[model samples]
Target chain A: MARIYNFSAGPSMLPEPVLQQAQQEMLDWRGSGMSVMEMSHRGPHFMAIAEQMKNDLIELLAVPANYRVLFLQAGASAQFAMIPQNILNGKTKACYVNTGAWSTAAIKEAGKYCEVQVAASGESTAFTTIPAYADWRVDPAAAYLHYTSNETIHGVEFNDIPDAGDLPLVCDMSSNILSRRVDIGHYGLIYAGAQKNMGPSGVTVVIVRDDLVGLEAKNTPAVFSYAQQAKADSMLNTPATYNWYLLGLTLQWLKGEGGVVAIEQRNIRKANKLYQAIDDSSLYRNPVDPACRSRMNVPFVLADATLDKAFLEQAEQQGLSTLAGHRSVGGMRASIYNAMPEAGVEALIEFMAEFERTH
Target chain B: MARIYNFSAGPSMLPEPVLQQAQQEMLDWRGSGMSVMEMSHRGPHFMAIAEQMKNDLIELLAVPANYRVLFLQAGASAQFAMIPQNILNGKTKACYVNTGAWSTAAIKEAGKYCEVQVAASGESTAFTTIPAYADWRVDPAAAYLHYTSNETIHGVEFNDIPDAGDLPLVCDMSSNILSRRVDIGHYGLIYAGAQKNMGPSGVTVVIVRDDLVGLEAKNTPAVFSYAQQAKADSMLNTPATYNWYLLGLTLQWLKGEGGVVAIEQRNIRKANKLYQAIDDSSLYRNPVDPACRSRMNVPFVLADATLDKAFLEQAEQQGLSTLAGHRSVGGMRASIYNAMPEAGVEALIEFMAEFERTH
Candidate 1:
């Protein structure tokens, strides 16, 4: 098989090893004579797989015992609605730090269930940098302070996790989850859609504080109820089983590759190489402040904007895919997620250098 | 790969051809060197697949242009909340015919958003039959009347579609979708989770009337808004691309096998054979009414209840799996879906007769 590098934002790239393992197990998973898709979610075989995934994740993230992990359908967008519905607790207000497109969406969804205050915002900077904590005004009695840890679209990140004082902190880490080490004890909730850095598009991993479990409003459907889903071990309704299985494969890969600490070093190296190239080059520049710039999504623009199309086309011919910036804010973005090998970054850097020399 | 029969009710059996095609295309989908799951939902490749799925479904169902198709996530269960959110249109009430588990769930979720009237119910018979249309007491002013066309758990089906008498009709055809022909014009909405007879669990197909597009409640999330999804051509968010691809393959298979008309006759034959054998046997009994018995799932109980355990264990050892009925109502269930060849059903019947004779 030919080596291919995919740079999609989500449903993006998976580890080649995971894909190979999946293909091998596609028809008969571990001698079960059934594809993981065909296994009964309730059967012992599937239950074991689900348990192993949850266990591996707990180990990978060092998830505290007081937190509940839920493998749910619908992506991080669903959690936008689910978070408030579960944690509103009759509180009329919630604090949100707007960092990028995803946090903006989270704030919008939170607004429906509670009064959301923009405690801090990176919007004024075109989402190129995280707002300083000194500028934030968090309410003492607010239910929780919501934030997006990594913004896939704008390529902005909070290098330092926010301090919410005593208020619970909810983070949407969809784009950069498991790429680095974090103190799981610090935040009240951490949710990441699996598409970008984890496994696939269908499942969202939600880790919530145990005390926050059963606070769903009267109208909450059983399917969306945190308490209900948690009690059911995220098998509340037949989960995206195949996706769960793939996640298990990815988690195993992460473990075999020396876990989060080892992976983070690789991620840092990859991001630093690309960012250094952009910072040192005259033809391209990344606008975000170096301190808060994302290590996952690197959004940069060409000095001569007219050359953008030609650059993208040339990049595509060389097999560099999905380097186009989000249409919401156009330029170019190269998402160097955990699944993206160091060699891919080296190749991208080589290509950029060659393109600049020619153009 | 070893051949096996999967008897799961939802996330159920897929066509062998579909699975084979998927396996063959796992590493390189159409020479693109990207699995369908790895493709960007927005890209040309995925857009083509999405459009083709819609076109094929329209062709299969003969759906009129006036009805818009939205491929959504979160399963049929999500539609439970979505229906009242979109269709209520300020109407105070919605009429729901309680057939079995799925309909009951829809009514429960709908109750949160609108006044839900039990227009008719099969609960009196433990959901063993579809409620007769003559017995219905629909609210003329209700926004829409909902029913489950086929109850997977109860093994009951509506042999005839109901007339809503000017009110819009909504059917949860999760278990019976694409098994037979239907007049799509009569429905305001037809939603089915694509796990049962369709493809996978993540993608839910909702065929809604064009007029029913723009009435989401002010609080409805953009992702769940039918009107919003329709405008985006079901690329509202990164959808279950692999699942959608599989659905297109199933639709292609249906078309190749002479479409729904041909499948329906075969289903009828399969159902008749299995039901007839149960009726003839002194040792077995299926409680559903003759007019309402499902062609998809046939739940039967042994007359000698003591042998039920032995029968299931022996059946499993022989590679006949998931014969145990739903926990809600337990005995034995043989789900003869479109993918279940007649030979499998015949083999099951032969095993049943042998077990009965030996006992």
Candidate 2:
């Protein structure tokens, strides 16, 4: 069978070119006589690969000189604990915005280390809309303010970076990091699991401003300390060598596709088409607010829940795989990240239309 | 260049058959129309992969029904902290045996969460020999006994398990797991990083006894909490999905080559041949105690210190790669894990003889 458009929320579709390049280099990487997985993390060959990957990511994101880009493990979930551990800096409280599942999770974890102040919440609106920034009650004395840039499950995203006053702004960009342009200078920290927009699972990218590098709480694991990891260039321990190489390949592929800016344009066009199709149809309706619906994960529900099984079965047959929405919000979700070609989205749209016409 | 014998301490060589299978399935996994990297970790396809991999490991290790095997991230370094955090069980002190570099590192991390009691030390012997078992000062009140079964950097290993009496025994088997048979019933927890004997760098295998599952310290990260992760089947977060698949493939290959009991015999032969060659050569020597020398990583030095660079260069030219010893130790090290074939070791021995004859 030909490669299908995988709509998995994470560990999702990667660029076909990246996969091809990986397969080509599986036995021996670039004449080095060893797979990337076999190279010593500290050896010359792997060091070169690691350096190029970090530099490419910094270049693609236009990250500020004052910030350090770290490739880590344990995903964005680890950062939920690490953010407060490293950046809380002796403060007794942290402010968090509860936009959806991801934010709520972060807030819960932060509560373990410090007093959590829920600055604002979208739960009142069933997580379908981002709470108005003007209405948020952020505590200025808090150590930092954290929020999830894109709520992957609820399909809500913030259109603009929210100001956190004097407190450092932290963002979890797991579902939408490279899909759009953002000034890295706006946040004190930004982290995303590579499984989504980057490459595969295992590696997490953390971009932190220089000032947030130190100040870990006592008893913090060395591997999770941003200060220690950044000092070692994220090689404080044996890293995920093969995953790093795959991530580098993906970034190189992105550059060939004209970097983040160009890719963002494509993402916006693709997202608009899918959302337009959803809005244009009566049978399918997206519950998320029009202004804040996630461009990476577009979730919708059919008017009649009875057709859900048939809709998914037919979509799978059409090679539009994993269209089911999150179990918490049962319907259908089409996660079209940067690697998800526009043709894949079009294919999903056509299938949805045909299904609606028949049912 | 052809695939050479990689002898890096970690992130070492993998079976060619595993790499070949991965390459063959890179674009589409068994007609799933998606790469394994593209599958949802929760979807049926990935769930099947995950199950098979876990079951294979359990079968290969003969893991007792009372043990839970977890596929985790952040490598074994994270386990250093997690072990104490999860199993301290309100005890203030834990006993640790210091054999070499890995044990020293584990002790350092474990100290952050509990009062570390040195049960025995090989440091007095320059980490070349394990201390006498009868001389160990085991504290009955301690929460657990921690020891590194094999040290990659120091080329040392424990010939037999140390009796901790009634205390839960924890072993860091990262560099030598699956190369030998062991009774899982004897351990409270056994953790190994996948880069060496298992598969890749992103995944760490943790086999923990049921009695040691809960009892996490306050504020422990959910992802690192053994009890919570066990309940979630190690899906507490998005795992390193592709890494797990690779590990599964490696395990399957191992099963085909004969399980741990069979691999142990081969490993013994490989290590013995390499050691015999070094002992026979007047130009080369290994400093480790013969009784407890590692079967995985064998660190040796040339009689003439000046020949180090030439030895590495000429070895590389002969397609023998990454033979350089760890930087901390400064010599030559050959890590012949389970995946390393007898032919590769024979090639190395032949090269060693030729190099000795010339220089």
Candidate 3:
């Protein structure tokens, strides 16, 4: 069987070229006589690989000179706890926007370390729309303001960065990071798991401004301390060597496809086509607000719930894999990240149309 | 270039068969039309892979029914903190044995969470030998007893498990796990980073007894909480999926190579031959006590300090790579984990003899 377009919410599709490069180097990486997985993290061979990866990511994101990029483990989920641990900075409270599942999770974790002020919530609208920023009641004494840039499960995304006044703005960009260009200067910190837009799972990329690097709470694990990790260049301990290599390969591939700017254009085209098909049909309807629907993960439901099983079965047969939405929201979701090509989205559209016509 | 013998301390060599299998399935895994890296961790394909890998490890270790094996991220470095956080069980003090560099580091991290009581110290002997059990000061009031089974940097290993008596026994087996057989029933928890005897660097394996599962200190990150993560089957977050697959492949390869018993025999033979060669040579010497010298990492120094650079250069030219000792204790170190074949060890011994004859 040939490669199929994997629509998994995460650990999803990767570009063919990146996989090919990794496959080619599986036995010996660039004549070094060791696979990337086999290299010592501190040795010259792996050091060079690590340096190039960090520099490439900084360049691609146009990260500011005052910021540090760290390649970490445990994904964005770790950052939920790390955010308050590193930057609460003796403050007693933190403000969080409750957008969807990811946001709610971050808020719950933050509650463990500090008083959590739910500045605003989309739950009132069933998480289908972003709450109006004007209605948010952020506490002036809050240490930081946090929000999920793109909710992977609810399919909601913030179109613009929210102002945090004097507090540092933190964002979880796990699902839509490299797919679009953003000014890194806008946030105090940005973190994303590599599984989605970057590469595979294991590595989490954290971009933090200078001021937010230090000031970790007492008893914070060294691995989760942004200040300690940044000083060591994210090699404070043995890193995920092979995952870093794969991430570097993916970033290089993204550059060859013309960096984030070019990929954003492709992503918009793909998302628009799929959403257009959904809106144009009576059988299928997307519940998310038109303005804030996630371009990375597009979730929709069929008019008749009985067709969900048949729709998924036929999609799998056609090589359209993992189209089922999250169990919490039972329908279908097409996660077309940067690695997901326009052709894959078109394939989904065509299949949906044919299924609607038949049923 | 063909694969060379890699002797790095931790992120070391993997079996070639495992790499070959991973490469063969890089693009599409067993006709799934998707790479293993691209599969949803919750999907049927990945669930099957995860199950098989866990069962194989359990079978290879002959793990008792009362233990839970977790595939986690952040390596054993994170476990340094997690062990204290999860099992302090309201006790203020925990006993720790300081054998070498790894034990020292673990003690440092554990101190942040609990009152650390030094049970024994090999430091007085420059970490070259383990202290006698009768001389160890076991604290009856302590929550647990922590010891590093093998020290990669100091080239020291414990020949047998230390009795913790009433306290739960925790062992950091990062560098030598699966290279020897051990009774799982003896331990309350056994943790290891996967870079050495396992597979790669991203995943950390934690095998914990059922009795030690729940008790977590307040503010422990949910991902690091044994009770929470065990309930979620270690998928508390998006795990290092590809790393888990690689680990599984490595475990399968180990099973084919006759499991831990067979590998232990090979490891002992490899260590003995390497040690005999060093002892026979006038130019080289191993400082560790013969009774407790590691059967995994063999750290040695040349009689002539000036020959260090030349030794490394010439060794590299002979395709013997990463033989440099850890920076903290410089000379030369050969980490011959379970994946290293007898032929590779023979090649190293032959090279050393030739180098000694000339210089």
TM-score of each: 0.98, 0.99, 0.99
| DockQ, computed on Cα atoms, for candidate 1 | 0.55
Interface RMSD of 1: 1.9
lDDT digits (tens) for residues B152-227 of candidate 2 = 9999988788898999999999998899988889999999999999898999999999989989988999889999
**lDDT, candidate 1, at B282:** 93
**Candidate 2 residue pairs that clash:** none
User: Which regions of candidate 2 are displaced past 4 Å?
Assistant: none
TM-score of 2: 0.99
Candidate 1 vs candidate 3: which has greater DockQ? 3
- Taking the tens digit of each residue's C-alpha lDDT, what string does model 3 give over B92-190? 999999999999999999989999999999998999889999999999999999999999999999888899998899999999889999998999999
The runs of at least 3 residues in candidate 1 whose Cα sits more than 4 Å from the true structure, single-residue gaps closed, are none
Model 3 residue B289 distance off true place after TM-score fit, in angstroms: 0.9
Which stretch of 10 consecutive residues in model 3 chain A shows the poorest summed lDDT?
A158-167
Candidate 3 lDDT by residue in tens digits, A1-359: 98887899999999999999999999999999999999999988899999999989999999999998999998888899999999999999999999999999999999899999999999989999998889999898999999999999999998888989988899999999988889889999999999998899999999999988889998999999999999999998999999999999999999999999999999999999999999999999999999999999999999999999999999999999999999988899999999998999999999999999999
lDDT of each: 0.87, 0.94, 0.94
Q: What tens-digit string does per-residue lDDT give for candidate 2 at A1-359?
A: 99998999999999999999999999999999999998899999999999999999999999999999999999899999999989989999999999999999999999899999999999999999988888999999999999999998999998899998888999999999989999999999999999998999999999999999988998999999998999899998999999999999999999999999899999999999999999999999999989898999999999999999999999999899999999988899999999999999999989889998999
i-RMS, every candidate? 1.9, 0.7, 0.7
lDDT of 2: 0.94
